[model samples]
Target: MVSLTPVDIEGFTFLAISVELPKTTLLVVTSERGYIMCGALDVGLLNERLKDRKILAGRAVGVKTIDELLEAPLESVTHEALDAGITPGMLGKDALLLML
Candidate 1:
């Protein structure tokens, strides 16, 4: 199953996605400029192999739902995200705010 939802934060709209497969689920919340995702995201690859893309993204581990992903602190973030003031240990929603 796949679910896409619109999340509102401080009057800003962000898109939340949930994909269920086998025993795991993928979760993500995205703003216009960037996104935050569950452990399935590869922050290292984004920072290293895909650095030129300047992808603004963050990853949070151990989150089972989009809401948890939004509330949890990021385990890692892309370099572009760092340059944009998003950082590891920043809450997902906070990172998203900066992304916007």
Candidate 2:
């Protein structure tokens, strides 16, 4: 299991997702709008998956923009996570560092 923390980005909200891999843990930073800015890649499958999906694929995967987040409900994030095959249970302790 991994943990994540919520962060604030220039007044926008962000969250960190910590995933357990075969050899190491990955920490990914995602905006409230669902944009994954950066993080660590420790899982081979995850690395491959990310590589297969072009960077910024989150936009097409259902992650919204700042404007979208302003109007979207919190459930939208959960829905996006589900669509991405990421479980809320899997994102418990990662800290969401704010980017201001």
Candidate 3:
């Protein structure tokens, strides 16, 4: 199953997406500039192999739902995200605010 919803955070609108698969679910919240995703995201690849693309994103581990993903602290973030002031240990919601 796949779900996509518009999420409001401090008056800003972001897109929340969830994809359910066997034994796992993929979760993500995205704004116009960046996004935060569940453990399925490969921060390393985004930071290194795709550095030229300058993707702004973060990853949170152990989040089973979009709400959890929003509340969870980021475990890793892309280099562009770092440049944009998003960092590991920052809450997913907080990181998103920076992306705006």
For all candidates in order, the CA lDDT equals 0.94, 0.37, 0.95
- Model 2 residue runs over 4 Å out of place are 37-100
Worst-scoring 10-residue span by lDDT in model 3: 43-52
Q: Candidate 2 vs. truth: CA RMSD?
A: 13.1
Displacement of residue 35 (Cα, Å) in model 2 is 2.9
Candidate 1 C-alpha lDDT tens digits along 14-99? 99999999999999999889999999999999989999999999999999988899899999999999999998999999999999
Q: What tens-digit string does per-residue lDDT give for candidate 2 at 1-100?
A: 7767665544555665566768655445564433432123223333355545432212112222333322222221223344555432232112122112
Those runs of model 3 whose alpha carbons end farther than 4 Å from true positions after fitting are none
Clashes of 3: 0
Residue-pair clashes per candidate, as listed? 0, 9, 0
List TM-score per model, in order. Answer: 0.98, 0.33, 0.98
lDDT of 1: 0.94
Candidate 1 stretches greater than 4 Å from native:
none
Model 2 lDDT at residue 90: 35
